[model samples]
Target: MKAIVLGTLMAAVAATGATFSKSAEANELALSLCTYVQGDDTMRMRKKLRDSRVRVRDIYSGIQCNGQSLLQFAMSNGSQDIGEFIVGRLSVDELKSSGDYEWAQSNGHAGSPIAAAIKERAGL
Candidate 1:
């Protein structure tokens, strides 16, 4: 019985590790999607991020926001359409909880003055 219990525990740990690994991979994919989106490579962004199986926003959390939100990342970089799309998809609280709102309000739109004004206008 003890042996069986130990084996189960070990299996559980391995499974958790595997799950985390997958999450990390998904996070990387999401960041890549953002990069493509920022570059206005919508075709690739759509192709990469369209799958519902991936939690794009959750993966986005892993991205270095540079004290700015995903919206700021998109807007300041000339990806306003994608920024709007993400805003439409994400709930207000999700935006806040993700720290994007605070970052946007504080970071000055990743150092872009125009994006900073946009952020202020949007009430971010």
Candidate 2:
């Protein structure tokens, strides 16, 4: 009985550790994504997402860099290439609901190239 209990506890501990590991990996990926956007390294960002087998849309809502979404971050950083790339990957519904155009307009980025891309993508 003690052995069975110990085994169950061990399994639980292992599962918890795996969960934490996955969370850490996600955080690392988010940081890398933010860095790539900030640097406007669209190629590297694409490679990283492809290699990780993750799509931008899947993780878009989950990541916040400096209190801004990836698209917003890209626009703020003047990372037009990456911004367009991100905009391209997202779905029309996602783009429309993201309100990125309004955010950009209110944030003094209305004239940015990235804002134009957002408007085009969102069909705004």
Candidate 3:
């Protein structure tokens, strides 16, 4: 009985460790994605997402780069390619609900190409 209990505890600990490891990896990926956006490295960003087998649409809402959403961060950093890429990847409903267009207009990015992309994607 004691041996069985020990095995169970070990299994639980291993599972918990694996969960934390996955969470850490996710955080690292998020950081890398944000850095790529800030640097306007669309190719690397695409590669990272593809290699990780994660879609932008899946992770976009969960990622906040310096208190801004990925789209907002891209626009603020003048990352037009990445901004458009992200827009293309997201669904129309996601685009509309993201409020990115309004954020752009309010943040003085109304004239930016990214703002235009947001407007088009969001159908505003």
TM-score of each: 0.54, 0.95, 0.96
Q: Note the Cα lDDT for every prediction shown.
A: 0.63, 0.93, 0.93
Which has the greatest TM-score? 3
Instruction: Give RMSD (Å) of candidate 2 vs. truth.
Output: 0.9
Provide backbone clash counts, one per model. Answer: 0, 0, 0
lDDT of each residue in 1-124, candidate 1, tens digit only: 9999999999999999999998887677756766776785766765676664654555555555444456667756777666655665555556656655555556565554433444454567
Error of 3 at 104 (Å): 0.4
Model 3, 5-123: lDDT tens digits are: 99999999999999999999999999999999999999999899989999999998999999999999998898899999999999999999988888988999999888888787777
Question: What is the lDDT for 20 in model 3?
Answer: 100
Query: For candidate 1, what is the TM-score?
Result: 0.54
The lDDT of model 1 is 0.63
Give me candidate 2's TM-score against the actual structure. Answer: 0.95
**Which of the predicted structures, 1 or 3, would earn the higher TM-score when compared with the native?**
3
Task: Spell out the clash pairs found in candidate 1.
Answer: none
Tell me the deviation in Å of residue 11 in model 3.
0.8
Instruction: Give the TM-score ranking, best first.
Output: 3, 2, 1
